[model samples]
Target: MKIGGLIKFTLIDFPGRPAAVIFTQGCNFRCRYCHNPELVYPHLFTEPVPQEEIFSFLQRRQGTLEGVVISGGEPTLQEGLIPFTADIKKMGYAVKLDTNGARPDVLAELLDKKLLDYIAMDLKAPLDKYSLITSVDTPPEILMKSMQLIRQSGVAYEFRTTYDKEVLTDADIQALEKLTDKEHYRVQECLPVAKEKAALKVLHKEI
Candidate 1:
């Protein structure tokens, strides 16, 4: 995997555990309010984080850190993810994957192999507004399939949306309810990064 960034430790990223977060580069979705804009836009790809260095840090923190969170522009997009995560698993660390859920086959394989401990899939928008929110041409059909796969996968998972008012509205929420069973969804307040603070505050008020 081409690791774009590595957070040595995080308290909130992986539920209760202190974990390392590996941010992979490149994404299929170009969400306008994406805080990690560098990850999504390849033109700005940062130098890859040295894998050996990351592994060494993980090894040192083995007893202290309980888990590792593999997040990305889209972690599943990287073909090396399985083997890379497999290595982490061997180091006796629980693994959690944060994905866009576009690749069901990869998700299935990882779960089947018991390589992942938890999964977090993002709902970019209401079904119909996917392309609009992503700022890219997205196939609603494929996204629907991914949603179904996750629901039925029986893995510990959460379906979350970063509710941004500029891209999502009440009508979009209704459309989301129609597309997905609302019982499985979680809506979160969009946290403002330094660059996105003003816009996020205004949208927070609207929400």
Candidate 2:
């Protein structure tokens, strides 16, 4: 767990449950409208928060916080994710994972082991516009598989899009809907946020 930052308590991140959010330090996607550029760009990364300190806090918050949100810079990049999550589960908190669906293999393993209570995948764009939006070459199959896994895993989940007008057209949004289950999807307004304050603000509002 290369933790860049931690929100000790949050009401909106885990839907109905109050939870603490751990923002991991690396990302695979480079979305143009992403507010957390400090987490995405390696040169902007800060020293990671100590895992011992994080666990100790979680231990103290056991009864107060009902859930833990493993957010990113793509948490699937962390090799310690499984054991870290297992440790939190042992602490009696539900775990929700927020991801870009870049790692279906990791998602599959977590689902197979029943490790997640909820999963939220960011739908960056329509399949054809993915690379244009992310500024990286992405395999559409990867996202497609990840979506399928989340949909069928029996784990509660949602697919969310930032809905950047500069990047996505109405047709693109409609096309994105076809790529995911509409019942489990949402579109969030894209806001202009300062990079420094964005971390705290983005967590309060949807991306």
Candidate 3:
């Protein structure tokens, strides 16, 4: 739980609730259009905010904040994620997780424990173009398995893709239809020069 950044309040992040956003550090995927380069690129990362500091803030916001959003450089990558989220839930706040869907095992465990209230998984691209878009050698099956786990977990969830014309084509979006029906999917526009505020607006919206 290395917290790279913290947004004390957000109206749109958790859907129908006021919440705080904790941005974790380090990512497995290196998408070219990633807006949070500080979270993803090690060289760009700043000193991590202490865990106690985050907890203290959450404690103070107890009645004010309805939920907590655990977003990341891939939150599941952090080994302490489950415990961290459990603690948040214990604090009487609902929790939401944003991830790349590369680790189905971790996702399953959290769902099994009823630790997350909502889950948002990013679909980097169609199976054939995944590696090219993610800039990693991610197995398509792994991503597919994560999708299956989310759908079957019966937890509220959404599958989203950043629509970057250079990295993903119209056909790629069409292919994503095979993964989930329309109700559970969203396509966000990712402009090359968009700032964090713009990106956050796109990422936090419900379809």
The model with the greatest TM-score is 2
Candidate 2 residues 43-141, lDDT tens each?
988778889988999999989999999998999989999889988898899999999999999999888888899999999988888887799998989
What shift in Å separates residue 59 of candidate 1 from its native position after superposition?
Answer: 0.6
Best prediction by lDDT: 2
Clash count in backbone of candidate 1: 0
What would you estimate as the lDDT of candidate 1?
A: 0.80
lDDT to native, each model: 0.80, 0.88, 0.87
Query: lDDT at 90 for candidate 1?
Result: 99
**Can you tell me which runs of candidate 2 are displaced by over 4 Å?**
195-207
lDDT string for model 3 (96-184, tens) is 99999999999989998999889999988888888887889988889989999889887888999999898777888988976688999
The residue-by-residue lDDT of candidate 1 on 45-95, one tens digit each, is 767777897799899999999999999889999988889999999999999
Order the candidates by TM-score, highest first.
2, 3, 1
Show the colliding residue pairs in model 2. none
At residue 147, candidate 2 shows an lDDT of 92
Deviation in Å, model 3, residue 196 alpha carbon: 2.3
Off by over 4 Å in 3: 197-207
